[model samples]
Target: MKEIESSNLFPDRLYLIYRVGRLAFSSGIFFLFLSLSSISKLPVAPSSLFILGIYVIVSVALLLFSKKPYTFEFLLDEAVIFTLVASNVLNYNFFSIFLIFPVFFSTIILGSISGTTSLIFGLFLHIIFFLQKHNEGIATGVQTVLNSTALIAMFVAGLKLERKLKSQAFYIKELEKEKERTEFYKRLYEISANMAHEIKNPLASIKGALELIKEGKQNERLLEIIFKETDRLDRIVKDFLHLSRPSSPIKTEIFLPEAFQEILQSLQHFGKNYKLDVEPIKFKTDARGFYSTIENIVRNAFQWADSKVEIHCHKNNHTLEIIVEDDGPGIPEEEREKIFEPFYSKNPNGSGLGLSIVNKFILENKGTVKVEKSKLGGARFVVRLPLSEEV
Candidate 1:
């Protein structure tokens, strides 16, 4: 909903363009005055001095309100250019080249009606000023008509260019909105389908467990089955919640060694051998997100790991690279990319969200998680979190 300056036909751009054009024209006029003085080997003409004074006043007024010039201001600028044209005719020198600049500005900024009015008035004055001196030469008439034709061409071109740019901007904005809507619907559909697929298995297991308990009477093992299935459902819900949570990392200061110490200790519940090698590095990041990222990564390693999981952490310049690898069957190169997709588990009982969450957390922290062949001949997952060159 923010208003764009470009959408307004770049009014500020118009100011810049007009000012630059006037500056260039004025420079040309200055050199012309100097050239005339040198050729005649005389002092500057009084008429040129008079014209220069009028030029200063007009230039100052126009420059002062360049951003929001009134229509009358543009008219005044054109009138001055006409005066220059008359002066050029009386002195028998052609300076009608300056006439197109004002016409171009008016057509672009004040619209075609005002621009057409200025053009007509300029041509009318052209006839009176130059045609009356037709006794001078026929080339003068030809040159004046050519100047008028070029001014008309420049005005028409400016109008079309303005219209084309404005139309393209409008279409680009509409396309962006359409693309956003399309992406929203596509993501909605994906989440719905993944949720249904992940939820169905646990619900089925819980229902089956309950039916068996009801027919055979309550028993310790059956109740445990129901409890376990319910826990699985809870985990599924929690994972989905993690995905839906605000993406911005809740950053705080964290010591890498101590944080990993607590994470590994809590991960003892997995009953898997995990060896940790961490450096005493400190930095600011989302503590909870970092923990989640490490936990999901190690848990995934533990799942496919055979005898033990090896974790190697070290500093690489401004990044902290955490390498988690297992000695079990490594992931194939082809499936590595797809493995991080939601509900893309190779394990029969796995819900397949752990690595996906790991990927999300790493990306949220402005980091990268990559899979490669480990030195230990297993799947090595390397997570690099940017430290921004902190010690």
Candidate 2:
């Protein structure tokens, strides 16, 4: 019902009026039936028949009018006014109570100005009927005054209720936005903590290596380890920044096989058997993000593969699919979902951020990556990217 109420099928004002119009139509039909049932006593009465005809026309017109813009509030208020006039023309004691419908709707929906106007008009009609039905008695005047007071009270109360509902809706929206901002900052803090922990060890190792060199330990292996630790620190910082502030994918035409082959070449020493099978097609995606996504996935695969890692790329319709599989012990099904979570790795030496970063880059490019058991007896990472317009 909330979804229905929020739907854009009709503008907000029109939608309210549309609902009221439906109610008016249904009420008019019900009264029309009642009048027809008593038609034998007043057969062919001109005023009753005229009111009946006008009510029928207006009821149908209200339904049709809802389809049009019908934005002007006065138009709906006037329609309800016509309904009140119909009740008056019918002259049935039961029908007079229907005068409250116009007052109720006009005040509740059209606000105070229109509400007060409707009240004045209803009072004028009430006075006419009251004068016709009674002599100048104090009791009659008292009843009229009491009825007017009750109508004014209802109008004021309805306006307050409408304002309260609007305020509550706005408050709920603000609370939701505040909750989102809080959650974002919380996630950011977690990422910063993890990055600091990961980078601290490598910096410490680099510091130890420099200290050893200062103590006359000029071994080539010591210098090499320092360089490797420095590189490790750089990579960690780079990955953190890449994950945090991802750029939007600016798709450009590039051959699928060539791109995959380039990534494979860089990690050739990581595994003995690096195989690539790609469809020769022009694909479109952000080159840097695309490269980072595949590189991180393949590097992880290479770390696990016993002897072989296979890369397969295909294009079908408007989707580009890439699958990287390795020949190693497959990932347990329970951990598959957790692998993409930041700082969640089973490997002791693993920073656990590679797959998380891969997922982020892929998502920024409007792609998805999933891990599953592979035919190669290891984890398989499947990437799906929507193809851009033809270059």
| Segments of candidate 2 deviating more than 4 angstroms | 1-152, 216-221, 244-251, 272-277, 305-310, 325-351, 370-380
Best candidate according to lDDT: 1
Would you give me the overall lDDT of model 2? 0.70
Angstrom error at residue 362, model 2? 3.5
lDDT of 2 by residue, 1-391 (tens): 3433453322356446655665565567556656766775544345545555565565566655654432244344434444444455433243334555555555555556766776677677557656765685676666666666666676677668556655666666676678778988998898778778888888888889899999998899988988888887777777767777756547677777788888778988874687788988886666777788888898899989999888898886888888999988979988888889887777656677788888887777678888888888898999988877545
Q: Candidate 1 lDDT, tens digit per residue, 32-51?
A: 77677778862455676567
Name the regions of candidate 1 deviating beyond 4 angstroms: 1-136, 217-221, 247-251, 268-275, 332-337, 388-391
344 Cα displacement, candidate 2 (Å): 4.3
Kindly report the root-mean-square deviation of model 1 from the true structure over all alpha carbons: 9.1
